[model samples]
Target: MSTVTTATNATTTHRSARSVARRTAWLAGALFWSAFAVLEAVNHGWLAGTLALTFFVLPDLTFLVALDDAPRMAKGQLPPCAVPYYNALHRALVPLALLVAYTVQPFFAWAPLFAALCGWMAHISYDRAFGYGLRTKEGFQRG
Candidate 1:
């Protein structure tokens, strides 16, 4: 193998380690918040729970998307198409889903808080499994 290839491989491996460390810490935090959401949902019944799930869980996931973009974009990538993507998840998809699940749904209604909470968890889990969020010698981009 060539020297450059070897060095590149080593760097990639090292970066992967750093990324995983960052991702792990991030995921741990998400888990804590997700747990809080679940507990709150249980207590609040529906409306409050739904709000809490969106307010709490969405941020947790959006963070992962931020993390994923770090290596590619040195600039803080705050979900470039975030508003549209977020709308799809929180507004269009979720409400429609809720309507299908429980008919006679009312406006200003809270859907399944558990489902929203799960959505957040899914993001964290997906990053942990696939993100390879490694820190590089270039270091993390600072805002």
Candidate 2:
């Protein structure tokens, strides 16, 4: 094979590896969260556990709806703002805010605040584990 062909093949293989690794990481994260939610439900109750799972997965859902690059940037549509709106939901502050609210009130008949907090943490962990760090205003993929 020509040098150019060899380089292209290497690049394609690298990208394929990265894609596979990313997908695997995502699958692992999903399994982890599902197991956690199930265990929580078994210990607590169904409603609270489901709520926790929903909160845990909320950031990704919001990102898919609002800030994902494929539907926006790939289509040549500029984002309305420099920072992606999803970043706001993905930060540690989300869980901190939940913690503060729980501290202030401490009253819950169902769906404890801890579940939401755990969900936020799980989201962050999954992103970090999968190498999906925070996106900068400059591009779709950045720390």
Using lDDT as the measure, the top candidate is: 2
Q: In candidate 2, what are the lDDT values of residues 11-122, reduced to their tens digit?
A: 9999989877876776676566556656666777766677777877777654444454545464433343534655776676667666567667747324445665666666
Residue 54 miss distance in model 2 (angstroms): 0.9
Instruction: Give the Cα error of residue 104 in candidate 2, in Å.
Output: 6.7
**Candidate 1 colliding pairs:** 15-134, 19-133, 19-134, 19-135
Cα error, residue 26 of model 1, in Å, equals: 1.8
> Global lDDT for candidate 1?
0.51
Model 1 alpha-carbon miss at residue 128, Å: 8.2
Q: lDDT score, residue 14, model 2?
A: 100
What's model 2's lDDT at 2? 100
TM-score of each: 0.40, 0.55
Which regions of candidate 2 deviate over 4 angstroms?
1-39, 64-72, 75-83, 100-105, 108-111
Per-candidate RMSD, Å: 12.9, 6.6
